[model samples]
Each structure stands twice: as C-alpha cells, then as structure tokens.
Target chain A: MTCKEVTRLISESLDRELPFYQRLSLHAHFHLCIFCKRYARQLLFIRETLRSLSQRIEDPVFSLPPLSEEARESMKRRIREQVLPPDQGNLEQ
Target chain B: MNRKQPIDQHQTSHPEVWVDQHGDYLFRYALLRLQNAELAQDLVQDTFLAALRARHSFTGQSSERTWLVGILKHKIIDYLRRSWRECPVDEIDSSLNSIEEFFDKTGHLRDISHGWTADPGTILEQREFQGILERCLAELPFRTATAFSLREMDGLPAEEICKILGISSGNLHVLLYRARTHLRHCLEIHWFVKIRKD
Candidate 1:
C-alpha cells in the first residue's frame, strides 16, 4: 500500500474496525514504513492516555458530594412543592 | 450499613430519589466531557429533570445506574447541539496544518516510547498533565472537540455519535479522525516531550 492509503486507513486500523485482510495489509505497510509506524504508536499512546484520564475522572471521590440530611430534606421539600398544589396541603389530613 | 438500607430502597423505588443520590456522579461525568463546569452542571440538571419527567419510560432493561447514565448521555448530546456549532469545512485544513506545526515545534514527533507509561493512576494525579490536556482541548474547534469528547471520554459508540450529531457515518469518521489527530499531536507535545525533558 502507498503512504496515502496507509495514512487514510490509520484511523480505521486504530478503531479495530478494519477487515482482517485490510488489517494485514496495514500492518505490513506499517512494518516497512517508518512514518506509519510512528503514526500507529502516536495513536496508541493518545488512546491509552485519554482512556486513563477518563477513568480518573470517574473516580468515586470526584463524584457528587453525598447528600447531607439538610440537603436531602430540602430536595424532598422542593419535590413536594412541585408535585403538590398549594390547595392540597389541607387535603392530606 | 443497616441505616443505609432505607435510603437505598428509596433510591431504587423512585427515579427522583436516584437523581438526588447520583446527581454528582452524573455531573462529574458530563463535566469531564464538556470541560465546562457550568454546562456540565446544567446537563446534569437537565438529565434529572428529563428522567423525572419520563419515569414511565423506564423498562428495567438496564440497571438504575445505566438508566440514569443513558438519560445523562442524551442530555449531553442535546446540550452539545444547542451550544456547539460546526466549523466551516474550509477551515479544517488550516487547523490541521497548525496542529502539525504545533507538534513539530514542540519536537513531539521524536520517539520516547521507552519512557512512556500508560497508567492512568500516575498520569491523572499530575497537575501539569491536566493543565496541558485542558489547553489541548481548548485548541480544538467546538464541534470536533465535543464529538471526540463524547466518543472517547464518554465511551459512546460511533453509531450513537452519528445519531446524536445528525451526521453521516463518513462525516463522523472524519470528525473523529481530525479530533484524534489533533489530540494525539497535542498530547505528544504537552505530555510526552515534557516527560522526556524531566
């Protein structure tokens, strides 16, 4: 494959979406081509690094703060106010 | 542990309860992708509001966590659509060229795979890396950045991305290719080269 063909296929190859024959052809080209090899390495590095970054972002500590009792009650009250009409306050009795 | 049971049961029983319980997780998830705290907070709020409004649609095919995340995903896409406009196709080539120059000047095209580490535990703990990533993300055109973040950071599939962005598969591939290429160059410049120097 020419450099242009290999270049065009780099994204698909990294995505693992290329057919087996296409993958083989790309691999063979990458082995013979210094630029394509560098491209593959860079792509791999970027993918791994971004994946790691995302995992850290999902850490439990980074999640929302736990609801304190006051906050929880406030949220409940807000929900009730939205769901209940003002005239219904006396109907519960 | 027993004291937590009622809370768990309440969350399981009502979607609103679940949102109150997991709003922070959803916010952080959106924030990482949006890279804007205010937008992320809004997306989380919209997600919960939509979930509460559509609770009857819940079919139990997935766990509550997955259900909440699904709603959040849609909310994010909606937010992206409203806030992000496409760059003219004419601008793509110039942006791509600039990115190439950025990489070249930073000497990131050189090899340092021997010293490169793939561990997120180490990489994310560093403030410099985070700052670099934020800068890199800022350099991207809005739509490309959003698409890339949704696919990579949010783990959404390309097909879903296409549906969300209303683009053809080919267009989505192109957008993703451009985004990834830019990010790869930036990461090399900001992280890899700096690490070698250190």
Candidate 2:
C-alpha cells in the first residue's frame, strides 16, 4: 500500500475499526515499510495519549461553580413560565 | 421562604424532566467537547429548551436520554460553527513533546507496549500530555472537531452522528479522517521535533 493509504488507515487500524482485508493489507504494508511502521507507532501513541488525557480530565470539578439555589429556582421558574401558559400557570395537572 | 420543588417533578410534559435528570451528565459531556464550562452549560440548557419546543418531533423510537443527547450534539455543532465564523484561524501549538521526551530520554516506549500504563496514578500525573492533547483538539477544524468529539468523547455511533450532523456517512468519515490525521501529525511533531529539542 502507498504511504497515503497507510496514512488514511492509521486511525482505523488503531481503533480496530477497519475490515479484515484492510487490516491485513495495512499489516503487510507496515511489515515491509519502516516509514509506515513509525507512522503506525506515532498514531498508536496519539490514541494512547488522548485516551489517557481524557481519563485524567474526565471528572474535573465542574469548572463553573454549582448553580446557587436562587439561580436554580429562577431558571426553573423561567422554564415553567415559558412552557406553562397563563391559563395553565399551575403546571401540575 | 417556600421550599423549591424538584425540577423533575415539575408537572408539565416539558423536556425539563430530561434535563433535570441528565443535565449534569450532558454538561460534563459537552464540557469535554467544548472545554469551556460556561459554553457546556449553555449547550445543555439550549438542548433541553429546544427539545421542549420541538417535543412533538420525538417519535420515542430511542430512549429519551439518547434523543436529548442527539439534540445536544447538534447544538454543539451549531455553537462551533458560530464560534468558528467569529474567530480567525490561527496556528496553535500541537506538539507531542512530553510523550516524545519521555520516550527518548527514558526509552519508556520499549518497556510499555502502550505509551501509558492503565494505572490511574501514572495517567493522572502526566499533566503535560493532557495539555498537549487538549491543544491538539483545539487545532482541529470546527466540524471535524465536533465530529471527533461526538464519536470519541461521547461514544456516539457513526449512524447517530451522521443523523445529528445532517451529513452523509461518507462526509462523516471524511471529517473523522481529517480530525484523526491532524491529531496524529500533531502528536508526531510533539514527539519527534519538539521533544528532541528539549
């Protein structure tokens, strides 16, 4: 396979999303091509790095502070007013 | 002062029930995609508000959670498009320096088949790697970034992403291709050139 083909398949290969024949072709190319091998390694590294980074940032303390009770109530009130018309002011039916 | 009622219990068949239940999760999901808490919160709120207005269109084929997420995904794309139009394309640092330096200086790549061990301790301590990945994501074109974030971060299926983005599967693949290629190149430059210099 050409470098362009290898490049296009790198992400799919890393994700294991490519079809069997495509995977075999990529494996064949990588086995013979040092550049493609390095490229595959780099792609793998990128995937690994992103996966780890996502895990680290997965649970950041909600950078914005929690909505205050007043703010929450105000938002609820606004939503209620918008959804419930004047005649249906009492949302509970 | 009157006690505040729970948002979920609010009686109208409004979509707020969905938000009340899933808002925080949606916010977290959007924050991961947008990397801006305020924007994430707004996106979640907009998702619910829009869903409420168009509640009729929901056919109930999928779970409500999935439907809301689908809506939120579109909101994210719209937000990205608006923001992209507002801002000029500028070069941002997209280096793989930290990972490269660690590999070159310490040769850890040989020891670990995966550059990162699955251990939580090692992963959390790699702050530079996290920063680089975030920077790399930011460098992606707006649509490509949205598609990758939806697929990778949100774990949405390709078909769902196509429906939400109103793009063909071929278009979706193209966007995903661009996103992944840009990320790979960014990582390579970070490792090969940036880290070697350091």
Q: TM-score for all predictions? A: 0.72, 0.57
Candidate 1 chain B weakest lDDT stretch, 10 residues: B1-10
Writing each residue's lDDT as its tens digit, candidate 2 over B28-72 gives 667768877667777777777777666657776787777887888
Candidate 1 lDDT, tens digit per residue, A1-93? 655456557875654388888889988986776766777766666666677677665565333233344544554555555544522443443
lDDT of 1 at B25: 66
Note the Cα lDDT for every prediction shown: 0.64, 0.60
Residue B171 CA displacement from its true place in model 2, Å: 3.8
Model 1 agreement with the true structure over B38-140: per-residue lDDT tens digits: 6676666566656665655666677777788888877877778766445465554554544334334433433333335546456656667777777887777
Best by TM-score: 1
